[model samples]
Structures are given as C-alpha cells and as structure tokens.
Target: MRPMNNAPLDTDRPNSLIIAPQWIGDAVMTEPLLRRLHARGERLTVGALPWVAPVYRAMPQVAEVIEFPFAHGGLQFRERRAIAKRVEGRFETAYVLPNSLKSALLPFLASIPRRVGYFGEARVGLLTHRLKNPKSKPPMVAFYSALSGESGFDADRPQLKFSDQDISAALARQGLPVSGYYVFAPGAEFGPAKRWPAKHFAELAASLDLPVLLLGSGKEAELCDEIVLLSNTANNAKCLSLAGKTSLTEALCLIAASRACISNDSGLMHVAAALGVRQVAIFGSSSPLHTPPLSDQASVLWLKNDASYQSPLDCAPCFERICPLGHTRCLNDISAQRVRDLL
Candidate 1:
C-alpha cells in the first residue's frame, strides 16, 4: 500500500489494480504499461518470479510483489488457491498477461471483479476486457499495452523500470573491473534450437581483444565451462565465467558495467536490453520483430540459408525445446566468423 498520488482510481468504472505477467521477460517488457497506469491514477501490484522475488520487490514502481511458489507451468492446486486467497479482496481489477489455459484460474478464483486479458486458450469468460490479439502487434510491448486498454503502444525495446537503490545495491555486490569488457550470455531456456554452439562462442571470445565475461544460470555451468576452456585467447588472461556466481540482481549490476553484451535471446538478454546496454543479441527460434532485445543498439543475428541447408528446419522457429530435427542447423549454421563480424 505505497501511497501513489491521490487521484481518481478508475477508468470511468472502478479502480485498484493488480497484474500478473506470464514470464520475467514479459514483466520487464511491461514497464510502460505500469507507467501508463500510474499516469491514470492506478497503484501497481505485481506477481513476481517463483525464486527471484527480491529482484522485482526492490523495484520502485512495484508497490507489492507476491511470488508464486510454482514455476511457470507447475500447477499445484492448493498452492494456487492459497495465493489467490492472499490476493483476494486486495484489488478490484486483475490483469493476466499469460495466454495459457490455466493463467486465468487464480485471478478468477480470487474473485477480482474486473479481470482483463486477451481472448486466448478459450478463456473468454474470465476476462472483462478480452482484447483481440492485433494483427500489427510486432513488438511484445504492444501486447502488454493491450492489458490495460492502452492504445498506440510505441514499439520500443523492452521497458524495465528499476530504482536508484536497486542500481546501487546491484553495483556494490559485483566488483568486476569494468575496463573494456563485453558480457556474453549465450544460453536460452527455449532449449537447444536457440543455443548457438558453445564452441563457436569460444571461437568468438578468442577473437575479441578485450575481456569477455561469460554469463548464465547454474544450469548452464557445464556449457559455460566448455566455452571458456576451449576458447583461444591471446594472453594469459581468460574469459570470466560468472554463470553460477551471481544472482539475477548481481548480474544486472555486472551487465551495466560492460561496454556492450552479446547474448542469445534469453532472460539475460532481456535484462541487458532493459539496462540499455549496447547489445548484439542473436535470435533463431524467436523472431526479432516478435521479441526484439530492448536496447536500440541491440542487433539480432539470424541464420541465412541457401540450397544446401535451407532454414533451421521446415519448422525452423517452432519455438520448441530440443529441435524436432536431430540437427540444429539454424544455430549451427551461424559460424563464429559471422558473430565475430558483428562483434
């Protein structure tokens, strides 16, 4: 219950708002929507990540953040109900940004009178404002804007809002030398199709005269190691792998330190984009227009195919885990030389 400015709290209807975005990247991308809500006299309460609740909790714009115990698709019935009860009678309007069949259940059961979301996965009865998924919705920002009926969403890089305190705290924790270093996050949760070969990353790191900071989660430790060990760097100094070392908040601080970053289209890339770091974010499964990195300086490197190996596969950007075709030509075809040129 942070006291936002005293103003009328409704859209010619009623006020008090709570919104739950489907994922971390989407949550970051919806900063403009929160800003717009603030403009129209609405208090913001967000549902945050399952484990990394502290990151968004410290965010200035987020007055309240309740972390769901379940991961993205983990539907624990009792747990969801308890969370819903906690949220019940807390807000008059709840916005569900996810399009899944079950994304509406919690909000619906919570008894939030005005639930707003898109008409997807046959959840028509759940949403008060069932926005038609627009034909011209290229950027994901537009999708977030539609949540609160905000029109003409300017397609920019992802919109993430953080506080000076958050920035300060994050920076103080990571004491990395900032002299000419480029952060490289070459992992994607979208699975193997999105991952450019680890060896290629090593190749790219060798070419760079400056420091290359390798970043990812604990799950990506082995991959990061393979990249670091195999990479051929000139002098004695090696690429610093901070994959398992820092939390999400610490990573944010380190990402801000670098001159630029090269990442696969993943959460780290989204965060880098939000920080407005100069980025070269390569994309394969996810198209640039659909989910471009937030920074204007971010460039997406995609695979080009000729007669020999046409597209990643017939179902190239299928956006699935473990490529349907055994070989991941889309990412494999993108040579380290091509990435080197971008760097």
Candidate 2:
C-alpha cells in the first residue's frame, strides 16, 4: 500500500472524500467523476478498498488515498468507528459510491457535514443528500458522473499515468519483448459465463502468428496455462502465460505496450481501455449498456443466446454469475474466426 499523505489540508480549498467502489471496473469508471471534482477545485481524497487502491493511487486527480481495511461484505462496525475517528473533521463532504448500508456507515459515523449517495439498503438517515438510482441501468461511467450533477452519456476516458521507464522495467523483469506482442485476457472474475472459451482463445492466438501474453489474476493461472499449451500446439508460435506473474501495475504497463488487446468483459479490459490500448472486448451473459469499456479504441462484440438450452430463462442478459441454464451458448456461439477478423 502507498503511504497516506498526512499533509495539512488547504483551508482555502473545499475538501471532499469519495467512498470508492470495490470492483476494479467500477473503480476505473469512477475516474471521470474524480477528474471533474478536481477540476472544480475540490481537494479530493479517495477511501478505497485494499485491492482496488492502486486504481485511485495512479490517478493524478486524487490528493490522497485512504485504505479501507475491512473485507468485502464484512461489516466490522468497530473497525469502521475507528477509521471514522482517525479521519474525523477532515472533509466537508463525502460521496458514497457503493449502495450497501455498510458503505455509508463510516461517513455518517464521522458526522461529515454532507453525505451524498443513491437511496438503497435503507440508508435514509445515513445520507444527507439521497439521489434516486435510475430504473434502467446506465453505463457505469455516466452513472457515476451523474452523482456530481454532471449529465451526459459520455465522459472523458479513464486515464492512468505510468512512466515509460516503469513500463520498460516491468517488461525486462518479466523477460518479455518491449513491443510486437498481443495480449489476451481470458479470465473474467464475474464468472465462467463472462469468459470466452479457452479453445476459441487458443485458436485465435494460433492464427495471429504473433507473441501472445496471457494476463490474469493468480486464480486464472491454470486457465491461462491451458490456453498457452493449446495455442503453442496449434501454431508453434511463442505464447507466454503471465497470469499471476505480474503485479497490477505491471499488467497495466504490459497492456499499454501491447499492439492490441483481446479480452473477455473484465477488469483488465477496462484497464486496457483506460490506457488507450486498442481492444476487442467480448461480452456474454452481461449487457454492454451497463458497463461498456469507456474508450473509442474499443470494439465490443455481444453474443446473446435467445434460445433456452435447459433452464426456463428467456432473457439474453441474465446478469447471473453462473448461467442458470448450465449451457453457455452465449459465449460458445462466438466463433474464433469472428474474433480473429476483428484483430
């Protein structure tokens, strides 16, 4: 974790603290709002979960980052009270990002003058200013920006700052070439339904005839290994499974250096988009309308399964982690040839 800035607050500047979202993609989407807040001359501090802290720390817009120590879905009321006490009377307002009642607890406990968030989880008294969530889900970027009273379907793409020196160092450390490589993100933290088939990815990598780097978290290392093996057999080209090998910052730099990136709808896709990497994002069991990559360089392909395989669910975007029907035709229907054509 980066050391917290303990500098005295500027009295002339209005201080604001944002309770950041936990998910990596949602955390990336929050950048536009942070940028706008900084532009308006609000000294910004982000309260982030431990895992997602790197996202805000990379942003120049953030003045400071406070690591929220509690585990996801774990209340830890005493811990919240301790945190509130530590940062008491520091900020004039707090922007609560998550809808959970637990998310609003710290700000309310600290007695921050203004608390703003959507009405959810019976948090009526916790928030001083309650915004109603839209009935229909909007793109996360627009939805988050709207919290600050900014109205738009579009916002500036999420940008992360990294030095070329850092990128070169990361590449050297991983024994990877500096350029002429394509990245494939085959892991989706959401569930298997959001992931493109491993066979399809292997086929695509084989046809590309370029160095392929597979990026993912430690959990996806096995999956990436399988793809690498299959790809090597198919094309006899170099395919390295770098899953779990690089840090988040290293992964960001690698994506920035790639010729192009092909990924399932996942956090790395958002990171690639943020870095202005040309990306082909595949979607299944989720709606692009809800959280599409906020980059003009991105091309999205959605494969919807209209026919029911076994379960009775008729909708294409079931939004469930695991497909209810058990058959993932939504992902299976997208051919390797189609994805290769995009590349």
Check candidate 2 and list the clashing pairs: none
Task: Put down candidate 1 lDDT per residue, 1-343, tens digits, no spaces.
Answer: 2222333343553444454565557666777677677677667766655444544653456566666666656666787677777666767877787776577778888888888888788988877778887767657777777676757777544445456665567656665554367888978876877888888888888878787888888988888888888884442455878888877766776777778888888877887888777888777666666787867767777663234555325665667777777776777777778777765
Count of clashing pairs, candidate 2: 0
lDDT tens digits, residue span 237-319, model 2: 58889999888878888998899999988998898889888899999888787778878889888854334344433557888
How accurate locally, in lDDT, is each candidate? 0.71, 0.86
Clashes of each: 2, 0
Worst 10 residues of 2 by lDDT: 304-313
TM-score of every candidate relative to the true structure: 0.82, 0.92
Off-target runs (Cα >4 Å) in candidate 2 are: 1-3, 153-156, 305-315
Top candidate on lDDT is: 2
Best candidate according to TM-score? 2
